[model samples]
Target: MTTAPKVALVTGATQGLGLALVEGLARRLAPDDTVYLTGRDAGRVAEAVRAVPGGGARVRGELLDVADPEAAALLAGRLEERHGGVDIVFNNAVMRVGPDDDPREIIDGYAEVNNFGTTRVLRAFGPLLRDGGRLIVVASSLGTLHHLAPVLHDRFDGLASLDEVDEQTAAWRDAVKDGTARSGAWPGFVNIPSKIAQVAAVRALAERRRERDAARGVLLAAVCPGMLNTPTSALWWDVGDAATPAQGAVPLLDLALGPVDPDHYGQLVRHGKVVPWRP
Candidate 1:
C-alpha cells in the first residue's frame, strides 16, 4: 500500500536554515508531497522554492510575513483550501534587528515576530495538522532557560517554568506600561526581555498542544540549531564557530520525522541533547 504524502509548510525559506529545511524535506518527501516555502519577499520566496534539490512541481512558494497576523491566517486558509490539511507546520522565521536599532523597537519587533508570529502560525494551522502531525518551532539555545544561566551571565537562571516566565514578562510589561522598566541595565534593550518572553510563549504553546487531544495528536517541539553562520548572524560580533546552514537543518529534520512520544513533545532539542522544557 502506498503511504499518503505528508504536507509541510516552512516559513522564511528564502535563505539560511529555513531554505535548507525546505531543501531537506523536498529530498526526503515523495513527489506528491507539498512543501510551502515562504518568505517576506516574493521574489526571494520564489527563488528559494526553485533552489530546492529536485526540480519538481511538488514544491511551491508563498509570500508570508509571519509577524502579520492577517497574513499568517490567509496562508493557512490558502493551504486549507488547497490541501484540506497539512502534516507539518514549521515555524522557522525570526527577526533580530541590528544592534544599532532602537532598543524598544527591537524588542517590540522581536516580540511581534518571534513570539506572536509563532502563536499565529500555530493558531492558523492547528486545525490543518493531520492526526499525529508534527509542529516544529525553530528556536535558539539562547531562548533556553536552562542555558540562560551559563549563556546569559547568570542573571535569571531561576526561571524554569512557563508560569515563572509569564510572571516575569508580566512584571516587565507592567513596568514598561507604568514607566518604570529600566533602560540602562546590562544588555539594556527590550530585545533581551522579548527573547525571554518568546521562549515562555513557546513553552506555553507546547503545554497547550499536549493538553489538546483533538488536534491530530500534535507533537510540538522547539529546536535550537546552534549558532549558524547565516546572513542573519552577520551583524553579531561573535557567532562562535558558526556551522553551515545544512548542519543547522539536522535537528529540525530529526524532530520532523522522529517517532511521536510524550517525552519528546514540547521539549527543546539542541546539539543532540534534549534540553528540558515544560510539557
Candidate 2:
C-alpha cells in the first residue's frame, strides 16, 4: 500500500512571500496531499486558495490571525480533530511597521505578533507536528548578527529558554521606548528585531520539543529569504527591483520538502542551505 500523503500549512498566505510560498508548495504537492492556507480574512483565504497555482483542489482555507493566541489554539484543535497532525508549518504572519507609526506602536506591534504571536503558534502546533516534520520561521537577513554587537550576538546564540527569549525581546522594546535602541544597536525597526526574536524562539522551542513529545524528529529552524520585490516591499523598505517573491520562496520551500537531515535541525537557513547565523 502507498503511504499517507503529507499535510502542510501556511500563515499570511494572501500575498507577498506568503502567497509565493503557497504557490511553490502547491506545484509540488502530491495528489493526496493537502496544504492549509490561513489568514485573518476568510475572504482573502478563500481567494488565495483559489488563486494559488494548483491550489483549487489541494489547498484548504482556514481563518486564522496569528496575533490572537486563542486563534492558534482553536485552529490547532481543529487540525488535531480533522487531520490528526500537520507535517510542515511556516510562520510568516507579521505586522508591518508603517513609515510614520510611533516607536511604541512599531515595537509593541512587532513583539505582539511577530514574537509572541509566533510563540503561541509554535506552542499550539508543537505537539501536532508529525514525526520527521519541520517548523520554518520566515525571518529577514536584517535580523542577523552582523548588525548586533558580538556580546549581543552570543546572547542570541545562547538563549537558554523561551522565558528568556520573551524577556530579551521585551527589553529591546523598552530600549526603543527610552530612545536608547539606536545606541543599543537594536535601532528600533520592526523587521530586524522581530525576526531576531523569531530566530530565538525557534532555538528555544527546539531545545525542549522532544521532552514534551517523544517523536523527536521535528526540525525547528528559521530562514531569512533574501530581500524580495513584492507588493508589500515598498510599504516597508525599498530594495530597488530586488529578487521576486518567487525567487525568495524557493529556499523556504526547500526546507519544507527536501532531503531529510537531522543536522539541519535548529539552524537558520538562507537560500536553501544552513548558514552561519552568528557571524
Candidate 3:
C-alpha cells in the first residue's frame, strides 16, 4: 500500500526566499506530496506554483493575504476539508515598505500585516496541524536579543521588561487614537518587529503543545534564512554581500524535512546551525 504524501503550506511563496522555499521543498519531497503555495497576488501565486522545478503537479496556488482574518479563516477551512491536516506550515510573508505619509502610520501598517497577520495564520491553522507536524517560521537575526537589545536601548530610555514593552505598545496605540503617536521611533525595516513577534509566538505555541501532551511530537521553530539577494533586502543587499536564494533555502529545508528533536523546538536556527536566542 502507498503511504499518503505529506502536505505543506508555504505563505508568501510568489517570490524571493519564499518562492525558493516552495521550489526547494517541491523538488525534495515526493511527487505525491502536496505543496500549497500562497501569495497575496493570485497571479503571482499561480506563477510560483508553476515555477517549481520538479513535481509541478504536486504544487497548487492559493491567493491568501495572511493578514486578512477572513482570508486566513477561509484557508484554514479549506485545508481542514481537503487534507484533514497539514504536515508543515511555513510562515514567510512580510511587508517592509516605508517612508509613509507618517512614520507612525507606516509602523502600524507593518505591525498589522507582519506581526498580527502571522499570528492570525498560526491561530487559524495551528489546530489542523497533525500530531507530529512542524511549524517553520521564517524569522531574521535582526530580531535576536543580541541585536534588539542594543536597538531598544538606543530608542527607549532603558531596557524594558516584556510587560513594559506590551504596555508601551498599548500606549502607542492609545497615542495613535489621540493623534500624538511618534513615527520617528518606529524601526523602518520589516524584519525586526515581524521576526521578534514570530519568535515569541512560536515559543508560546511550543509551550502550549508541550502542555497539551509531552509526546505530541509537534515541532515549532523559527529560522533566519540569512541575508539573501532578495527584493526584501534589495536596499541593503549589497551591504554584506548576501547569498543566493538557493543557498538561503538550506536552513529552511533542514527545519522542514530533517531530523526531529524536541530540544530544538522553539529555537532559532540560522546558517545551517542552531543558535541560542535566550540565556
Candidate 4:
C-alpha cells in the first residue's frame, strides 16, 4: 500500500530561515507531497517556490500578511478543501520594528506581528492538522526566560496554561497603553517580548492537547535556530560568527518530521536539544 502525501505550510517563506525551511521541507517530501510557501507578496512567494531545491515542483506558493486573520483563514480553508487536512503548520513569520518614542506603538506593532499573528495562524490552521501532525513556531530563545521584569519573570517562565497566557497578553497591552512598558523592564527590543510570548503560547497550546485531546498526537513546539548569518541578520549580528541559514534549519526540519516526542511539545529547543529553558 502506498502512503498518502502530507501537506506542510511554512509562513514567510520568501527569504531567510523561512526560505531555508521550504528547501529542507522539500527534501522530506515525496513526489506527491505538497509544501505551501507563503509570504506577504505574491510575486516573491511565486519566485521563491522555484528557488527551492529539486526545482520546487512539489512546492506551492501562497500569499499572506501574518497580521491578516482573514487571509490566514482563507488559506486554511483552501488547504482543507484541497488535501482534506494539513499535516504541518510552520508559524515562521516574524517582524522586528524599532523602539519608537511611543513605546506603546512599538509594543503593539511587535505583538501584532510576532505574538498575535502567530496565534492567529495556529488557531486558523490547527483544526486542520491531522492526527500525529506537528505545529512548529519559529522563535528566539535569547530572552525567553531571564529578560523580563522581576515581577513578570515568574509569569513568563511558569505560564501554567493557555488561559493564563491570554491574561498575560492582556497585561502586556495594558502596560503598553499605560506608558509603563519600558519602565517595567520589558527590554529595549521587541524581539525580547515577542519570543517570550511565542514560547508561552506554544506551551499553553501543547498543554491543551495533553489535557483535552490526547488521542490525536498533534505536537507543538517553539524552536530557536540560534543566531543565523542570513543577509538580514548579519548586519546587526557583528558580535560573533553565527550559523548559516541552512545550519539553522536543522532543528526545525528534524522536529517537523520526527518520532513525535510529547516532551518536546511546548518545549523550546536550542542547539538540537531541549535546554533548561531558564532563559
Listing every candidate in turn, what is its Cα RMSD in Å to the true structure after a full C-alpha superposition? 4.5, 2.6, 4.4, 2.6
lDDT of each: 0.70, 0.78, 0.70, 0.77
Decide which is better by TM-score, 1 or 2.
2
Q: Please report how far candidate 1 places residue 35 from its true position, in Å.
A: 0.7
Kindly report which residue stretches of model 3 are placed more than 4 angstroms away from their true locations once superposed.
98-102, 149-190, 211-214, 237-240
Per-residue C-alpha lDDT of model 3 across residues 130-191, encoded as one tens digit per residue: 87788888887765555454444332222223233334444544555445533434344445
Assess every candidate by TM-score: 0.81, 0.89, 0.82, 0.88
Candidate 4: RMSD to truth: 2.6
Error in Å for residue 17 of model 3: 0.7
Instruction: Report the C-alpha lDDT of model 4 over 43-136, residue by residue, as the tens digit.
Output: 8998998788784328889988877858788888988999999988889998755324455666666677787788788778877888878888
lDDT of 2 by residue, 1-279 (tens): 866678888888888888888777778878688888899998988898888766322888999888786999999999888889988899989877777778765677668788888888888887788877878888876666766667567556668777788888888878887778777656456566777778878877777764443355667888888888865677776878688888889878887888656666676788767766676
Clashing pairs in 4: none
Show pairs that collide, candidate 1. none
Candidate 1 per-residue lDDT over residues 132-178, each given as its tens digit = 78877787665655433343433333445455544565555555544
Query: Counting only residues 3 or more apart in sequence or on different chains, how many pairs clash (N, Cα, C under 3 Å) in candidate 1?
Result: 0
Task: Determine which window of 10 residues in candidate 1 has minimal summed lDDT.
Answer: 147-156
Off by over 4 Å in 1: 55-57, 146-180, 183-191, 211-217, 237-240, 277-279
